[model samples]
Structure formats: structure tokens, C-alpha cells
Target chain A: MPALIEAKNVTKIFGGGLLDKSRTVALKDFSFQIDSDNPSVTSIVGESGSGKTTLARMLLGLAAPTEGEVLYNGKNLEKLGGSDRRQFLRDVQVIFQDPFEVYNPFYRIDHVLETPIKNFKLADTEKGRRDLMIESLEAVGIRPEEILGRFPHELSGGQRQRIMVARALLLRPKLIIADEPVSMVDASLRATILGSLLRLNREFGISLIYITHDLTTAFQVSEDIMVLYRGSLAEAGDVDQVVRHPEHPYTRLLVGSIPLPDPDLPWEGERAIGRPAGELGVQGDEYCQFHDRCPYAMPMCVQTHPPLFHTHPNRVTSCYLYRESPELPMPQMTSIFKSSNREGPPEETEQLDALDAELEVSQENSSTPTSADD
Target chain B: MVEETLSAEEPTAAELKETLKVEDLHVYFHTAAGAVKAVNGVSFSLKSGERFGLVGESGSGKSTIALSLLRLIKPPGKIEGGHVFLNGTDLVTLTEEQMRRKRLDEIALVAQGAMNSLNPVRRIRDQFILAYKDHDIDVKRSGLEERIGDLLTRVGLNREVANMFPHELSGGMKQRVCIALAISLSPSVIIADEPTSALDVVVQWQVMDTLRSVQEDLGASVILIGHDMGLMAQFVDRLGVMYAGKLVEIATVRDMFGDPLHPYGQMLIASLPSLESRKARLEGIPGITPSLLNPPSGCPFHTRCPKVMDHCSSVTPILQEVRPDHWVACHLYEEA
Candidate 1:
């Protein structure tokens, strides 16, 4: 069977138009397939400008890739015929990051829910439309009475987002692209939204493409996770294998950065602040994008970008360390748990007055004219 | 008025002098519909150099409390009753001019969405200069140019960034610049509202480290307001849990996370998906946040409290000491 959605060597370049000197490679030679037959959640996890949003847009057919094709059901998304295109549009839906912005403040709440029903012709009668709306809303744990005759301003952010989910559920979309759906929502309420998505995936067998920078939530919801670093694929594979045992140095950094809830498990060593973003959007194809920040980077990484190499049947990592024969000596790999922060008994440093006096002297020195030269 | 409102117990001579104290604050928004009690009778104290964390869902008055501290609450939303003390001096009695001077000099605020807080039209250096001037400091006489460079480097930015406008910096960079500006004067107290919520995890870590290091360098107390329980656990010395315009619990960070006394605090910690323990299901607190315009009668959390009782609707719960250094406002823990 043809995949529901597939990106074949997709690349997106922004601002390289006729008169523009600047060019940004949002996604570079990226490819992934969401199988149609088997419905499961696929997560594209990356930081800002890593091209997760661009990928979501391409999959939704909202934007065309600059260099490659996005295939829907084995047919190019751009080339789909009238009915096929409509079908494709109806099948793939998006849940945006901010719920407040997605909704129109002027309209009544039902307008958003009803528009999908009317456009898709899911129901003919008013009663039928109402019933469908109620059913969809109920599926997302919202009652009809709660949302009935309410304006967009009447609902909370979580409620507004749940309504969006319900509106998408009304379409019975085969695939849903949730781009940071829970990022705007509170942590206490995130479980409800995530739970709703998981239930839909299981009960209705809907394929979900969860795009987010949050790795922990991605681990919770996604079966297959793709970690992106500056538009290049860092690692891709089973979430358990990838997250539990992240292969890439960037992926390890990402895993280590997650703030664990345990107070007992404080950061082991001194936390290192990230280097300032150095010359974004202008890297040579051969140069590894993560070289500057990668602790395990070798001299070869500056000369050549490592292609995706299979570490196991279930995992692929783009790193020279995983290579069979590396010219440079491998940097010692630190265990994320131990190396994340130096392991020590939590310090009971009560001598702040003494420290403050020292800090005061240093502060005065730094402010002095002579200190600048020194 | 401050003395009358404060409970009978006096501060012991041995007790540490609080860097900032908020006592029984009530800030309401006088909207057309009705007065929305955004912050109702909330109180907490920050000892000098303590990093305090406030965690709650949106519309739970966390930001309002932060705003209330700075007296930044605009018209139609006013602090109805409160005593904000800095080293035992009441801020509520200060005039506009006095309050203005107190801001940035004594208590600095790194507001939420600080990237957007920078003036789009102004250069970074001008903003810093303007802030110093607003606090009645002559930037040129103080050699603020060199100080600005030092501040930028302290937050991991180049001195050259002072020439750039807000548009020139990345979100994370802009946030660091805001931190730099906040700490330029080395204020006694700093209130950072959702400082890292917008940044990526790695960048968030970096920003947090910068803030921590900056706080340590200045020996300044910090009140970090964010909803991420995990980040709060790692960052703060004490945790204040707010809900529906009131602080429902206050405890040390270790106690709050190790064994939360309040039901809301417990559910909040439980709802979060911990990397350490991937629990099969997260028991998210039920119901949406109550509308502050017409909140529940007795306890704000009673509407959704898992251990709610019939008496919960009639009697308001006061934050009482449930354990040594831990306070909870639930009726379940109320003393006879």
C-alpha cells in the first residue's frame, strides 16, 4: 500500500528570490514516510527554525517544497486532481500552536465547528450537523452545554484548543498534523490534550504527525521520532530506542536538557550555557551543522557532514562517531545521567555572606576602568 | 494599616530579613461585566538571595501577582488592598515618584514575552540608557556603555549587540538581553515571569543557567514565575502554588516536589510527565480554570478538588502551617 504521506529528499529555501542575497535552507534533503495502512503517531522534534513547521506545512500541502516532492497516497500533492485534492484536503488537518489566534473573536463558537461539517458535507440537516458537532465535541471530553451559544472569548485556552481538536475530529481526518498543539496549553492541562490525541489514534486509527520541540511529550505520544538539528536529520527511529538510548551527540544534549521533576535528581555538574547562535542559515552542504556545539565533534565534521548511518535495525544516527572507521580518535562518550551534571550529594552551602563579600569586590573591579584592560 | 492587617506574631530578631514580602494582596480588574478579583489575599515572602518559584495554570493570577509587586497594574485593574514590603518598608504607601525610583533600582522585573518587551524602534543601548535614566541614573556619568558591554557578555552576548535593534536578535538572544537589562543595576529582588517558556529546551537551559549565574554574581533574590513544575523543582529554593487568585500552598522546593501537601499541588506534580517515571496515565486535575469574574463561593479550587467536601463551599481556607516551613490552604489540613 502507498504511504499516506511521503517526503522524498525535500528541501526548502527561503529568501533566495530574484533580488535577495540571503538564502535560508529550512529543510535540507529531508525525507520521511507516514504509512497509510498502519496508523501511528510520527513526531518531528527540533528546536526553532529546524524546519519542523516547514515539514508540517509541506505535508499539509499548504506550501510546496523548493527541491523535492511531497507525495500523498503515492500521488504528488501538487498534482492531485479535483476530487483527489478535495479528498486529500479533507483527510489532512492541522491543530495549530495558539488556540486564541486560530479562533475568530467575532464569531460564535459553533461557527468554527459547523463550518467543517458544511464544507465537507458531512451532514445535510441542522439537527444532523448539531448532532455531529456534539459527538465530536464529546469525543474530546467537551459537553455540548459547555460550548453551546458561547463566543471564542468565553472559553479558556485549553477549551479553545480542545474545540479545535473536536472540529478536526468532525472531519474524521485520516491524518492530523499537530504543530506544538500543547505548547501554548498549561502543563496541568497538557495531559488531557495529549490523552485525547492518543485516544483518537488508538480508537479511530488516525495517523498523527506530532511536531514539537518538547522531547518528553513527543516520547509520550509518538511511536517513531525524528530528531532534527538545523534542518538536517540527526537521528530517526523508534522513540524508545532513540530517546532511551539517543545515539547522536545533539540528541544526547537534547535528552540531557529535559528538566526532570525529581528534586533528588538535581543537575549533576555545573550547567553549561549554550553558545550564542553562530551564523545561522549559511552553512556549506558538506559542513556538519552541529559541529560548533557538538562536544564529540572531530576535525572531519568541519569538512564533511555525516550521512545517516544505521546504528541498529531500528535506529539511524547522523554522526561520525557511529561510523565504522573514523580517522580521528573518538571522544569519550559520557553517560547522560552521570555526565549531565557531576554526581555529588546535594550541597548545603550556607556561607552566602562570605560569598557575597567576594562577589561585591569582583563587581567593583569589573566596574572599574582598569578592570577592562586586565 | 500594614501592622493591623499583619497577623499578631512579630518577626523574631533571629529570623532572616525578607528581601520581599507580599501580605494579603487583593488586586481586582474593574471590567464592565464586574470586578474580577485577579489576585485575592495572596501572601509570600522571599528571603535575601532566595530563588522563589510560583507555578499555576493560566488565569490563576501568577502574572497578576508579579505585576502587583511592581505596581505595574494598569487602570481598571488596581491593587485593592495589600502591603508589599521590601526589607520591612511598605511599598503600598509609596507615591508614584517613589514607586518609579524603587522599580529597576530595588525590584527589577523581567516580564513575560520579554523579547517583545524591547522597543522595536529603539536600539538596544538606548533601551538600557533609557532604563537607567528612568531610574534617575545618568548613564554617561556612570560609564553605562562599558557596563552594558559587561552585562551583555555576562548573559553570553557580544558587546556589539548594543548597536542592534530588537529585530536583529534571536528569541533566545533577546531574552538574554532582557535579563542583562534587568540585572544591570544589580537590584535586590528580580521577578522573572515565564522567562524561558518561549525558548527551546536547550536554549531554555542556557537562559536558566545565565539567570542563575547572574543571580549568584549579584547576590540578588529572584521570584521566577513559570508553570513548568520540573524546571521549578530544579531552579527554585521555595515553591508557591497559586490557583484562582490566591496562593494555595507554599513550601520549600524539595518539600513541594517530594511530598506536596495541597491537593492542587499534588495533582499538578502528578499531571506532569516525568522523564524519570513514564507513568501509564497522568491524572490531570479536572475542569477548566474558574472564571475570576464569578469565582466559586468558598475555595477557588473547591470546584475541581478531588478531595472536596460539603464544608468546602461555605468556609474559605486560610494558608496554615501544615508542616515546618510548609503551608497549605486546603480545608483538609485546616486546624480545629
Candidate 2:
């Protein structure tokens, strides 16, 4: 069976001209797929520079990958023409992080629901279109009377976000890529917004790719999760296994950092890890990207990057500690770490302290905008 | 100190002194439409070196109360009636000049979005120097740099960060710089409004850890205002739940998390996604927050309260001690 959407070794590199020496690898050699037959919710978890958004853009065909290709229905996305392209556009919809920015201030909320119906020709008559709009709005639990004639600013943040979900439902897409949908909403309304998205998969038979920096929400909603670290896949597996028992050092740190809502379980015993300072992707791609901040960095990690090794059933982790597992395909690299003298990992406290000083000096030359825009 | 006094079952004269006390505070914005009571008759007190969290949805007056405490509300928005006692000094009655002098010396503010609060054109050291100059602190030029460096080190940043501009640092580093600046005066009260809301989870933990350490070192009471309940549960000693300009519940963190008394607090706590157990369906609070312009008649949360009675809409419930230390403003706990 052909995949509904697929990314084959996708890579995205931003900036770096003949004159410019600096280039940022937003994503590196990443591959993913969503099956057409099975509807599932997959979460792409990452930090600010983790390239989750870049991957979403490539899947939507908004941006082309520097090296690999995105395939829709087993055909290259860039080469699709006529009906195939329109079908792809209709089959996959998106809900952005900021709900307020997506709507136009000049028009009423009806403009948002009406344009897609007219463009797609989802309804034959005006009455039919109005019925479809009301059905979609009711599906997301918004009363049409209170919402129809109001301007975008008149609605609250939670209401606006629910409207965005309702608009996506009008298209009846097979897959919806929600990028931090509930991050901006208040704590009280987050569960409501997330519940609507979950209903799309359970009741409406739509697949979903939830992209967020929050692991707790991802765990609650997704069946499968992919942890991204600086544009590389750190861990991938079932959400239950990965989040409950994370194997990758980065994944473990990410899961451990979540502040549980129980006061009895205070965050204790975990030493604070200082953030590494420097431009991402500046480190040589041949070495493990996480070795600098990783607590269990071995000598081999500094010499060669580790590939994703199958650690358990339905689980893969990119760490040298699991290199000896039977499922490792690269047999030649496994022996290299075993032969190295087992010395205690270099004292990280002093190195981390030194890096803090270096970070201040290195950032002195970059002219990034400050919080003046806020 | 107050904890020890409470444990003895008797309040001594010295330990009875609260670091900060707010009584019947009312903040209103006089707009063309009407008077929006942003904060109405809210009263709370902070013991010395205690961490108190004020949590609510948007427009719940959490931030307004913070500004009111510091006398930072501008025109159109006025402190209609209130008394903010800081070390027995009523800030509402102080003149403009006196209030200006009192700020950063007795009370300080670590505003949200640290990048916006710091000047882009100035180096980190210059901003610290300007703060010192504003309060007229007498420190020699040669020792000023050392003092700034020491403050930076206390917040887990390198002393060399003082020479770098604000734009050069990352988000976490910038917040640490803000935390360092907040403790420079060693003020008795520090109001940090959503200090880590803009940061990533990993960076948030690091920054909160830094804030916790520096706050402990200074032994200053913190008034943390935010909407994140999980963060509040973990960081604060006592939590206050606000709804439509009113504090509906106040209790120790453990008690509030274990057994929330008010319906609003219960719904808010139940809505949070927990790592320990995943529910099939999360029960969110029904209905939206009422507008402050014309809030609900008597009890602000009566419209959404699950156990609301007939009198809840006509008569307001006063916040009273339902348990030993837990306070709830609900008719369910009120005596006839």
C-alpha cells in the first residue's frame, strides 16, 4: 500500500552562499511516513531549533528539501500536477500555532469558513454550504449563532483556535498537521482544544501529526512519538514505551524535565544541565551532536556518530550505549567503543563552566534582534 | 519564621509581622464603556521568605494585582480603593517621588519576556549601573563592576556576561540576566510575572532552578503570577486560584493539589494532563471567563460552578477558612 505522505531522507539547509560561510542545517537526513490504511496520531517533539516545523513545511510542500524528496501517494510532491496536486492539498490540512494571526481582521468569521467551501466546491448551493459550516462548527462545540457574524478579534483565543479546527474539518482531510495548537491557549482551554483534535482521529477517521515542545501533551494524545534533537532523530517508538522508559540521553532529559502537577513529587536529584552555547549544526556532522551536553558521552561518540539501533521491539534509539544490541546493522562500529580504554568521562563541570564563558563571547558578534519587538 | 510560629500554635509579636499584606484591594480601569473591576476586594498576605503563586486564566487580575502592589498602574487604570502594606508601609498613600524611591529598594519587579525589559542598545553592565544610579546607591566606580559580576555569578551566569549586549544572549541566558538584576538590591519582595513562559521546557527547568536558588540566597518573598498550574504546583509553597477578579481559593500547594475545595479550582486541577496517569477524557472547565466590564452578578464563578446553588447568583460567598489553613469562597462551605 502506498503511504498517504512520506519523506525520504529529507534535508533542509538554510543560508550559506559562496560569500557567506555560515549555513544552518535545519533538518538532516530525516525520513518519515504515514500509512494510508491505518489512521494514527504521531507527535514530532523537539525544542526551538529542532527542525520539526521545517519537516512540516516540507510535508505540506510549502518548502522544498535541499536533498531528498517528499512523496504523496508514491509520486514526487514537486512533480504533481493538476488533479493530483489539488487532491494532495485537500487531503492534508494544517492548524498553525497562532490562531489569531491566521484570520483577517477586516472580515467576519464567516469568511474563514466560507472561502474553503467555495474554493473546493464542497457544497452545491448557498443553503448546502451554510449547513456544512454549521455542522463543522457544532462538531467542535461552538454555537453558530454566537460565532457566525462576529469579527475575528471579538472571539476569545480558545474560540478562535476551535474555529481553525472546525475550518480544517470542513475539508475533511485525511491528515491534519497541528503545530503547537494549544501552546498559546490558556491552561483551562487546552484540554478542550486537544480533545477536538483527538476526536478528528477517533470519530472522523483522520490521521494527525502533533508537533510540540511539550512532552506531557504529546504523551496524552499521540500513539507514536519522534524525539528530535538539533535537526536529528534522537528516539522513535511507541509513546507509552518512549515517554515512560526513555532510552536516549536527550529523550530521558526531556522527559525528566517536565514539571509534574503533583506537589508531592517535587523535582529532585536531577542536576541542572547548562544549555550549550553556539550556532546549531556548527559541530561537525560526523560526530554525535549531543555529546557535548550528554552525561554519558563515550570516546567513540566523539569520533563517530551513532545510527538508530533497534533496542527493543518497536523502539529505536541513537546512542552508542545500545551499539552492542543484536539488532544493530552496522557491525563494524560496535567493536570500536569496546577497545577504547575505559576512562571516566571527562570532568563536565569545568567544561560546562568554560562553555558558559565562551557562549557570552561568541554571541557578542551576532546581531540578533532583542526583545524590542515585544 | 512564620512556619515555626504557626507550628507552636501561638503567634509571637516578632513572627506575626508579615512581609507584605494586601487588604480589600480594588483596581478598576475607567474605560468609556464602563468601569472594569480588574481586581475586586482581593485580600492576601505573604509571610517572610514565602513563595506565593497567583494563578488564573487570561484577564483574571493576576497581573493587575502584581502591578497594584508596586503602584505601577497608570491613568485610566486606578487603584480605586486598597492598601498595600510593605513592611508596615502603605504604598498606596506614598507620593510619586517616594514611590519611585521605594521601588527596587524595598520591592522589585522581574517583568515577563526578559528580552523586552532589557534595553537592546545597552550592555548588561550599563543597565545594572543605571538601576543603581536610579536608587542613588553609593558604590565606587571600581567596585561597581565587581558587584555586578558577583550578582551574575549568583544566577549561574559567567561574570563576562556583563560585557555582552542583551541581543547576544539566548532566551534562558537573558532571563538569568534578569534574575541577576532583580536580586541586585536584595529587596524584601520580588514579583516575577511569567518569568519562564517564553522558554522551552529544558531551558525552563534550568531558569526556574536558577530563580529558586537565587531567591533562597536572598531569602526574599516571591509573588509569582502565571497561568501554568503544573509549574505553580511544583514551585510555590501556597497557591491562590483567581477567577474574574476574585481569589476564589487559597491553600497550601499540597492541600490544593490533593483536595481542591472550590469548583473552579477542582476543574482547573482536573484539566491538567498528568504524567502519572492518562485519563480517557479530560474534564475542562465549561464556559468562558466572564468579562470584567460587567461581571456576573454576585459570585464571579457562579455561571460555571458545577455545584452552584440559587443564592450563588444573588449573594457573593466570602472567602473563609473551611479547613485549618484552606480558604474557599463557595456557598457549599458557607454556614446558613
Candidate 3:
């Protein structure tokens, strides 16, 4: 089956020279495919500095991958001509995280909608343009009457974002790259944005590649999930399966860190392990990017990087926790305190109780303003 | 200290907040778009030593309320109406110099975005020392560095790091330094505006924990301004939802999230992704937050409200106590 979007060994390396190693690696040797034949939403979830945005940028053609290929229908995106690129643009529209960025501010609300129409050449006459604008606005659940003459400042953040979504609908694109689309919209108004995106994917069969640091919102709109950490794939699989039972320690910690909306539920116990920032890829070329932070990290992990092995039928993980290869050793403990299973210390329960009461306020709630805040 | 048991049965949030009543507060800005009614007749009460959250999307008059409390709204912006009473003291009536003395000593603010809140060039210790001096905290210059270090350690940061510039520390640490400075004065009320927005999830937890513990240590009431329901739910005891330039709903976090009444409040809670209910599709409130300049005549949320009525377009709803201790301003609740 021809995938709607496909990336093979895509690496986005931003730096000066080979030995310099001054640049940050945004996406490292990432490969994934989403089939157009069965269009479904895929979520790319990662915390800050996790190359999720970098991957989205490379896939959207805003920037090219440093190492591998980003192909649409098996065609090289970088090689596409201006017209073909236009067609690609028409097919793959984007709903940006910040709605303010999409608007020129100088132009009226109608102008923002009208310009997209003119650029795509979707309408021929003034009446046709008006009709097209109305249809696009209506398609995204926005009334043309209220939004047509309004200025960007005249509308709310949620409404402005709807206008952004409406602009994307102007083209009826097959693949919509929504990079934290709902992050800027208000919580009360966030659902409408998610609903609109869902409608686009379900009703119009538009395949969406949703990028977000928030697992809950990402899971709300997407079916498949890809976990990225420090520019490398951590876990990729069915959204429900991966989210419900996260394989990688990083994913587990991420899910664990998510703050529940309920005020009473505090994640005080079993604190998530912090990222040891200074511990950059120690074992030369073959080591998991998340090895520094993994609570269950084994010594063998330092020498050999785990491949993205197909563990669960629909899921894949790049962690040695599932590695049973004969070549790989039953790794002895790297850190003495690896798991809770081996604990035999006295007064451990008392220590755990004290740790349990400290409100884990930041773990799950500390999300970079996705689509909700400026 | 206005001593009222935090667990008292009859201690209503309004009654508690009434010790500091902001009556018919109106903050306006003369922008090119005409008079931007940034805070229009915005009135909410905060009793001494009770955490009250003023929540709304950006431009919803949340930040304005905080600035208005401190008389910090700069030129082009003016407090056109209303009174703000903190501990029965009318803050609006106080002179600039009078307020300056009372600023950190009484009314303190933790500004939005931790990065911008701290002075980039200044050392964290110096800022603390300066803030301490501003609040008239008695401490000599010789032992100021050690005291600053002790304070940083209290907020969960290494004391030695205080010597470094603001840029060197992580977002969360800088926020803690800001918290440390804000708390250094031991102000009666601390207003933190979007304090955790810039930090990472793990760091956010630590920062919030620090805020919670610090609030506990001071026994001072906090008015948190933010967009995250999850964070506020855990941090604040009471919550207020603002729209355009008016507060739409105010209630306990438990009530707001457990059983929301207002269309906007219900929508806000429903939009969140919680662990327990993996509800297949999230129901986000449709439309956008309205602009303050010439906002909707009746209900500020009417333009985007799903259950909006005809009367909601013409008549503004006052913040009324719909439920016991739950203050909501909506036509739907006006009938109730």
C-alpha cells in the first residue's frame, strides 16, 4: 500500500562541522509510514527538546532531512517543482500551533481566508471566492456571517484558531499537518478544534499527522502514537495499546507524569526519573538516546543500541528492555536501584509514604503552551 | 492575620474573598481599536489566606485584574471604575508611593513567564537582596548572600547557583528564583500569573510543589493566574473563570471539575484529557474567546456558546452565586 507520508532514516542535524559537534540533533535516523489506503490519524508525542516539532517540520517540507528521505506517494519531496510543490501544498495543508502566526494582522479576517483561496486558485470570481470562503468557514464549523468582516483581534483565540482550521479546509487537503493545533485555543474551546480535526479525518478522509507534547490531547484526536525523545524514536504503536501500556520506560514515565484533570489525584508516589542532561550519548554510536534518563537502564544498553523491534504486532520500540537477542547479554544492573521489585530495605513503606504526599504538580501539568497559551 | 479555619463549614469563598472585595472594577485601555475594555466591571472577592484562581484565556482580563490589584496597569491603560480592598484596605485609593511601600509588603505579583520575570543581567542573589530591602526585611549586606542562599535552598535550588545570571539556570529554576524573590518579602498575598507556562512537565511539577509548599510555609493566600485546569485543580482551593473583561464563574476546583454548571466552565473541563475517562472524542467548546473591544452585549461567551439564547445577546449577566459558594455570571444560571 502506498503510504500517504513516508520517511526513511530521516535525520535533521543542525550544526557547523563534523568534529565540531556543536549543533543539536533534532531527529535522528527516524523511519515511519502512514498508509493513505486506510487513512488514520497518527500522533507524534514528546516533551520539550524531543524532536517531535523537528520531525513535523521535515515532513511538512519546511526543512529537509539531513540524512534520509521524506517521500509523499514514494516521490521525493525535495525534488518537486514549483507547480508540483503547489499541488503538494494543496494536498498537504498545515494547521499551525499559534493562530497569530498564520494571520498577517494587517489584513482583515476575510482577507486571511481570501488570500489562501487566491493562492490555491480555488475560486475564479469574487462571488466564487465568497462562496468558497463561506464553504471553507462552514466546513470547519465556523459561520461565515460572524467571521467574514471581523478582524483577527475582533475574534477570540479559539475563533481565530478555527479560522486557521477553516483556512486549511479551503484546499480539502489529504494530509493535514497539525503541529499542536489545539495548544493555542482555550480549554473550553479546545474540544471544537479537536472535533473539527476529527471531522476532517473521519468525514473528509483527511489523514492528519498530529504533533504535540501533550499525550492526552494527542490521544484524543489520534489513533496511532509515535514517542520521540531527544530526536530519536522511543516507542511507536497503536495509540490505545502504547498509551495504556507504554513499553519504553520514557513513555511509562511520560504517561505517569501526566496530571489528571481532577484536583484530588496527585502523582506524588513513584516519582518519574529526571533526564541526566550532562550524560550525552556515552557509548560512541550505539546507545539509546533516552538511556541517560531510563530508570530501568541496563549495562548492555550502554554498548548496543536497540533496534526498533516489532514486539507487539502493531507496536515497535527502540529499547533493550524487550531485547531477547542471543547476542545481547542478560544485562547486569547498571544502577543498583533499578527496580522496585528488588527492594528489601527496612522502613521502605514509610519512605514511600512520605514521597507519595509531595504533590507531583509539574510532571504532567508542565506542558509548553501547546495551542492554548501564547 | 484574618484567621478563619480553612476547613470551616460556613467559610464561603466569597465571604473569605470579601475581605478583599474588588467592586465594579473597570480597567480600560485607549487602543487604536477604540477603548479596549480590558477589565470591565470586573469584581471578585478574595478572603485572607485562601488561594483564589483567576482563570481565562489570554485577553480575557485575567492579567488585567492582577495588574489592577497592584495599580500596575501602565499608561494608555487606566482604572476607569471600581474599588479593590485588600484586608479591608482600599488598594485603589492608595497613592503610588504609599502602594510602593505596600507593594511587596502587602500586594506582590509573580509575573507571567518566569524567564521575563527575572532580570537577565542581575545575579539572583542581588535581586533577592533588593526585593528584601524593598519589603523592608531586616538583613545586613554581609549575611545577605547566605540568607539568599538559604532561601534558594528552601525553594529547591542550589544556593551557589544564585551567583549565575538568569540565562544559566533552567526555566523552572529561574521561576523558583522568581518565587524566592516574591516570597522573600513574605507578602500577605502572592499573585502568580502563568508561572509554570514556560517550564517542562517534570519541572512544572517541582515548581508547583515549591509554590504549594511555600504557600503552606507562609500561610499567605495565593491568586494564581493560568490556563491549565490540571495545574490549578491541584494548586488552588477556589477557581474563577474570566471572559472578555469579566469573571464568568468562580468556584472550588472540586466543584468546577467534578460538576461544572456554566457553559464555558463545563466546556473548559470537558476539553481536558484526563486519565480515568479515556472518552474517545473530546468535546471542546465551539467558537473563540471574544475580543474585549466591543465584546458581546449580554454574555461574553454568547458568540461561541452552544446553548446560547436570544436574551444572552443583549443583557450582561452579573457574577451571581448560583450554588452555595459557587459564583457564576451567566444568563443560564440567572434563572436558577
Return the lDDT, model 2, position B201.
83
Per-residue lDDT of model 1, residues A67-154, tens digit only:
8899999999999999999999888999999998998889999999888888889999999999999988777767677676778776
B-chain TM-scores per prediction: 0.94, 0.94, 0.90
Winner on lDDT between 1 and 2 is 2
**Accuracy of chain B in candidate 2 (TM-score):** 0.94
Candidate 2, A165-281: lDDT as tens digits: 999999999999999999998887787777778777766878899999999989877767889999988888777788989999998888888888888776642344533644233
lDDT of 1 at B128: 91
DockQ of candidate 2 against the true complex: 0.26
Quick one: ranking by TM-score, best first? 2, 1, 3
Question: In terms of lDDT, which candidate is stronger, 2 or 3?
Answer: 2
Q: Write the residue-wise lDDT of candidate 3 on A285-350 in tens digits.
A: 577776776777677776777776666656777788787522211111101111112232112222
Error of 3 at B323 (Å): 4.5
Q: On a 0 to 1 TM-score scale, where does candidate 3 land against the true structure?
A: 0.83
DockQ of each model vs. true complex: 0.23, 0.26, 0.25
- The alpha-carbon deviation from the true structure for residue B18 of candidate 2, after best TM-score superposition, in angstroms, is 0.6
Q: Pick the candidate with the highest TM-score.
A: 2
Which pairs clash in model 1? A268-A341, A268-A342, A269-A341, A269-A342
- Top candidate on lDDT is 2
Off by over 4 Å in 2: A17-21, A268-283, A326-374, B1-16
